[model samples]
Target: MSSSTSTSTSTSTDDETSSPARRRSPLRALFGRGSLDIQSTLLVMLLAVSFLAAIVIGSVGYVNGRDSLRAAAFDQVTSIRESRARDVERTLAGVQQAVVLDSRNDSALQASLDFNAGFAALDEQSIDPARQQAVTAYYEDTFVPRLDEATGSSTDPSLLEPTSPAQAYLQSLYTVPFDDDFDASLAFDAADDGSAWSQARSDHHDYFREMVDQLGYEDVLLLDLDGDVVYSAFSGVDLGTNVEDGPYSRTPLADVWATALESNTVDSSFTTDFEPYAPSLGVPTAWIASPVGSGADVSGVLAVQVPTETIDSVMTGDEGWADQGLGRTGEAYLAGPDETMRSTSRELIEHPDTFAADVVDHGTPTDVAQRQVATGSSVLLQPVATTAVEAALQGRTATTVNTDYLGHEVLAAYAPIDVEGLNWVVVAKVDTAEAFAPVDVFTRNLLLSTAAIIVVVSLLSLLLAQVFVRPVRRLQHAVNRVSGGEIGVEVPVKGHDEFSELGGAFNDMSRSLKVKQDLIDEQRRENDRLLRTLMPEAMAKRYKEGEETIAEDHTDVAVVYADVAGFDDFSRGMRSGERLALLDGLWRSFDEAAERLGVEKVRSSQQGYLASCGLTVPRIDNARRVVDFTLELEGILERFNATNSSRVALRAGIDTGQVTSGLVGRTSMVYDMWGDAVTLAHRVQDVSSQAGIYATERVVQKIGDGVPAVDSGTVTTQSGEQRVFRLERPAA
Candidate 1:
């Protein structure tokens, strides 16, 4: 009994394991036919499509957003740049006006004019050698004294009061030229290494030193038109250090002098470099040159130099001005046209050679330079420069780009500085990564959020697919039922959102579909009615099916034309309602007759009707039909003429021709016949003598020879074409 029980228990265990109702083996489920879950596959596809759609939309949104941001930034930058440039231009204009006013107040100019007037006032006899010498001395020395006495120090204040040491020195020099002994002494010293001139030069140097101190400049240099440094603010510097001596001195000073000379001629301003002086002084300096003379000629250049730190202080004074906006940082530099570093920030000044080398290495395109100067506005999205000089020369007020400047990517801005007489370009630069750091952060966060949203949507789609499978299956069955003509199948709607609205719309659509089906049946019957009126039912059906119907050719077809006389006057007198009614009545009558005669009505115009016979129903007696039509029309008109107060009449012209007739015009097809016979028929109606039937010669011959007619003389049309016609009556 124990052995049998153990064997039964083992069999029971095996039966339980192998039972068909037990959970199916995962391996068999995976490998079995028809085992793939369609619902799960559809869910995966939906998730994939949604993810791809999200990515596409996000990518487009990101690009468009970035472009819009960049464009707005560029516009803002451009406006600010233009505003700054206008301010600079206005300031420069004020300085120019001041200079011009000052030039007119020049004492030397007034004195020379007075001297000329005084000399012109004197006779030629009074201009002898002794007299001339006396006059010259008196005019040079005493004339100024007399003027001072007469004006009482108020006539010309800048000259009368020596406000500056330079003015004082100039005053003293004016008296020396008038003093005979001092002039002789200067000539004697000129022969002896210019000792007398040296004293004057020393005085001038002292004056420059005092002026430099007063003006708050670190150094000042006075340059002649020949590029000679005649005076230096620093003491013990040689008076005659010709700028043309050494290569460094020659090239840089020559460039500065040339720029200064050019500025003077135009009463403009420019920046220049100290060159050899930069290395010697252990600090670089820039010179700002302005002209000092009044009429026609410029005397010399007054150049002042300040430490670069001064400019730095000015640029950084307002933090708000420099900040620009988010993700931007900057540094400023002042440079001359020769690409020489003038004044710059501490960083650039400390590494002079490096910055200078960078500036000198690059060149600016001519078109960009012209635009920068001419428009005086900022350019954004311009190509970044590898060098400081190139950045300045390119003329953009701001630039944001990744570039290898001194072997590093940098963002830069170069603003033009229009100091009174200075042509300086200010460049600001920063590390590219530092400037664009905020953008990178924003972009990264945006991408991360987008990725998270996509993942959530994909997971949500799987859950939603399982939840909606049964409801969607029911909706699919209902849709199939509706499509298969099982109407009024109620679909259960559970939601209150768009899905509920969709259910309501589906119910309405079902009702509308039934109504539309009934209407279509009624329309088919109505279309058959319209077809019988238009043509034979069979032909109309063929036309409705888009089959082209070739009209059969008929020889000797009868064409009739009738037109209203004095219709323009009648139309003008009649009300629009009356006119329309009249036209409707006339066309209806014409159309009825045409249908009864089995004739094809070609076209009807505003004041006329045209019909053709023997086209659809070809008959050898087309002329006889035409004559019958004319007599019938005459009888209709005669009855109207007896009863009408308007006395309107219809004139009919008939012609028979072998012509090709077909519908013309794609959108509004109208039957028309084209041939010389058609033209002659129209001419016969136009040139007819009275309101009666006029027939062309060909039409007359076609009607039987027994037909009675009166010969109308040949009439010449407007184009000088002769057409013979006759008034015809049907055989009596």
Candidate 2:
């Protein structure tokens, strides 16, 4: 019985110990004692967050990088295009300037003047009966004999026959003494005095020679006022034949002459590929012409005929960019204004029809070629030869683009060549894929680098989450306490790392946020004060929201332009501050008067002030506004004259005009007016002499018959000449 009792006690003790151990094991598992479930879950969340962060960062970086690179590339292209354009413009400017300078030279002008004077004097003197008879005899006998000796013919031959240099030289000499029939044949005895004839010949020859020498060009044909070639350095061509006889003779010289007469500036090219002479010559030439004159008068046109080869060399020369692995590779072709290829490589030159056949077949070309011809630069990626051709015709540079040219995608650059009188476009093209090869390589490398980093970051996120979960939980609790208004809650710094800094920062941020909120409230009050000072509450709020106030046009507006005489000199001598003060004082007084008159002051500058009436309020008496303003300005000046020794008087000119007043410039806004009426008002002010007020005829009419105006004659401006009248107060 004792043995049975002992066995039952042992069994109950074992059961009690085993039950507690089983329950403790399950509790430990739930709280992450042995299993890595808690760590694993935290790690998975961290990796997912890291992966999202990496993708976001990588995408943002790629987009930013791509945009930056694209901007840089576009900038590079713009710089290159602008540089080339400027160079071309500058070259044209230089040629124009040179021609003007040549025309203005004392020697050239004096020579031309002397020649005309000499002819006039000769006409008067050579009209005497005795001299006339002598000239008539000289022309029939001595002149004809000399002409036959020089030209090897008695009568003038048809211009159809090819001319010889000797004949041309003789013709030039013969025209000297043949001013009249009497002068041509008249001859004194060899033994008698020959001074007049010899002197006349020498003077004539010298004038012609000097004039020819001044036009120092070989490929150019120099025409006289009559459109006849006076001289040609090339092939020794003479000008006795009509202009229609020459290759480009039928082309209108009148157009060039008219352009030269109207504008002192002349830099233009003409095309003539369809002309009879062009095809006969085998290569079309460009004709570039510039007016030879100063601002005074158009002397003559200086034209040059440049061959295609000359232009080709200039367009394709090797430079710094060419050596830097950025060389442009393509076939260059010259096309006429008619869209016909003028010149190309020998192979393409023989087959001009196939110049841009692939692009033309696709029918996707815009009016890019036409725009290029007109504006001088039009970038296009189209499959059309006509497009490029049209651009050349408009005197513009163009680019031809296509996904494939004969099965190869191409990017072409076209430049207009204005040679002589011809319009030719130079096209350079290369494979598009090859051109962007570098960019592709860079993009691939970037993507690969980003992928590698993402993988590495994902693995590192797992380890980091495992190491910092306990510390992070403690920090989170501290942050919550601080956020709940528990000040001075200490967050334990477990490591000298970002987590420790983050804990301290969070504590500081809580304090800072409260201070910042208070400061923000104070700033809002300050801003309200400023807003009240600048504008009404409603208007200020609307302005803050970036809403623009609509402005109505004032029909009965009185436009005023006030200018100071000798202000230009004052500005030059005085310091900027003193000048500013003077201007400010004048403007302040003007502004006060404008406010009283219910007018809106538009703009003010160092030169003058411009203002308008009936902008804020409807004007009942627009004429009265002008009169009152003028009188008020005079009174102010009179007061100034008494007080200040150095008196500054303002000249106020007034006129009535329709005005659309509105604010301009976002940062520094100003009210301004646009249209012809406003311009006319300003011009009226400009025409005023000293302190006088000049008004246009329209303004004077509006003032009624009561206000007398003195006729001020007419003033001419870019708009047109206008009859101006001087405005003054009626004698009282």
Candidate 3:
């Protein structure tokens, strides 16, 4: 470990004899023995010791910090997803209410029922001539044109006579133009004949058309009690066709019709899960079918087409997702009971072709991402296979880590939606790569920072060794003269480092062997002040009066850890100067509690404070004192909030066990303690949720006999059970 020169000195020190004064302040003790041998060896030892210790501390810190940051990230992501799912459910519920109100107020339904009753009263077969003409006109103009645009069909749909229900649906494939009012479109050439049949067809078509435009439906249909499409606003080709015998017999709409027929009350309605509606060029769609009735007699069903874009807007905010905090790859979407996505993806919405193309190029054809992209429907109708969706579809709420539809690892939250008549699930997720990106950056930056610190320390160690050793060479010359009985000679001490101080000490020793007897009284008083700094009063007195080493073995010592939370988010938001100012002020307040309680304050770091009681000064109430100190921290934090307008709180952990206590690190004089007890105290801090003072069973066993400790119960993990308690600060 030592450099070439340091190795040679070590060999020389092994050969030469060491003297007594050179043994006192170890560095001066080593050099005063006629050798650079020990000084060079000590230089290497100090560098190696500090550098290795720093590497160890840095590694442990980086690992713990990385884990904590990852935990915070997951919590943030879960919250974002839950909020989005609630929003989606709330928006859909409102829309469902709108449909129910509109269906109840649809005037065309009453008029159609009135006309049907009148026509049935006619013994001979009767049909509305004006209604027939309007149907033909609607086919020739709107239906034929929009169909041609949607499917690129040049054939005029009106030219084909409407002999079948399929043909009838094709003729009414387009909605009414926004310019035409429903009242005007439905107003037939009615005379004083008092027959409503004249505009029965016009009334049905015009009212449904107006509803689609006003309520933003893609299409609307009126199906009778027998599952027959009696009228259609956009895709009216299915009129007069029973769903079981119609061209769209196999679709989800037909299945929902059985439920729709039964929902005859004004408030009752049926909402179907998505399926390809053959009537609408075989595109994916969902419909809310409200009952069209006269009291208890169900006349028909008013099926309003839910535009996929409405749900898309709910998932992908109309403005953008800046407020959602889902990052680049996060998205919210709905999944039907059939497990297919029922809303458009943000990826597909942004770059429609890219997702499909990427999935194809990657060759994972069976993947959900590929399937959704390939569906080509306005609302995605692709099946997904994942734990979150599966659990959500089963009506369970879940937040988990899983491989997403795209085969990318994601942190996902899914919840079953309980809309009036739809079975759907909301899934909100983000690619783990984007979500935990800071962890990677943090690790790299930590390594770079540690490397820089090591390099600087290495360089400073070498530089200081040379600087300190320069004066020691002069002291070596002066020590030789003093040893040879040349008492007048002095070692010029010119610096503040170890060697200069050693040289000064030697100069003092050689000049004052005659005066050393006179200065003994002064040194004893200085020792008294130092003892007070190092330990409690009783121990300090023993140490000063002549205890060689101050140490104790305690059967029960209560170790406590108190930390301020949200510091990462806090420090990141503030300027460097401001951050240090805040921490300095906060710690100053934190230290006061330990100072007043006679609890030995050990050390403080970014992880926060460490303290212990009943070691230096023996006491039976170590746990009691530790809990009291923690409660003081709560008050300090409470005051900190009142003054700073901040909600930042302290989180603490307490444990009772045996530990060795002593003054360690000889040169610097550090009074420190350690054991399994210390580690558990820190571990408890991690397990706690907030600024809650938690104590372990060991602390409880000792404190419970006297103090009122509320058992907080145990945190059972796969690893083991950790029993803890919360101090309900025993009724004063």
Q: How many residue pairs clash per model?
A: 1, 32, 9
**Which candidate ranks first by lDDT, i.e. highest?**
3
TM-scores for every candidate against the unseen true structure: 0.37, 0.38, 0.52
Task: Flag the better candidate by TM-score, 2 or 3.
Answer: 3
Instruction: Rank the candidate models, highest lDDT first.
Output: 3, 1, 2
Cα lDDT of model 3 by residue, 1-732, tens digit: 000010000011221234444433444454455544655766787678877888888879888878887776777666766776777678667666766665666474674464445333431333355544555676567555655554445855544334353333223222232212333322322323443333455445456566666777776666666565655554334545567765567766687677766655767767776665544544667777777665676676777777677777778777376566877888878888766688876766667667776444444354545446545443544556578889997889867889776667888888887786778888888888887788888888888988888888878877777765667667777766655445556777665878677777777787785365235445545655555544556765554444557677777788987888766566687898898888878877777788798687766656577789877677788788888888888888889778877777778889888887665543345555677677777777656465578888878777666656666767553447878777665555
lDDT value, residue 558 of candidate 1: 83
Best by TM-score: 3
- Candidate with the larger lDDT of 2 and 3: 3
- Give the candidates in order of TM-score, highest first: 3, 2, 1
For each candidate, the alpha-carbon lDDT, in order, equals 0.51, 0.50, 0.65
TM accuracy, model 1: 0.37
Candidate 3 Cα RMSD (Å): 45.0
Per-model C-alpha RMSD: 39.8, 56.6, 45.0
- Estimate candidate 1's alpha-carbon lDDT, on a 0 to 1 scale: 0.51
The weakest ten consecutive residues by lDDT in model 3 span: 1-10
Candidate 2 lDDT by residue in tens digits, 1-732: 000000000001232234444534543443433445555778877777877877787678777776676444434433444444344345444544554454455444443343333323432332334433443454455544544543335633232222323223323334324442322222211112233323333444343344334533224434434444443323221322224444335544434544444455533333233221221121234444455444555455554444444433333332234542234533444455545444333222233344345334545343422322332211222223545456646766645555433345555555665434445455554455555554566678777877787678767876777576666666656655544545456666656788788767765765675576466656666765555332334434554555566344667777777776655554567798987887678667877786676565666666676766665567777666765676666666567556654556666666776777544455443335655567676666656455667777877887777667888777675757888887776778
Worst 10 residues of 1 by lDDT: 1-10
**Candidate 3 — which residues are off by over 4 angstroms?**
1-61, 106-198, 201-207, 294-297, 361-381, 455-473, 480-488, 493-732
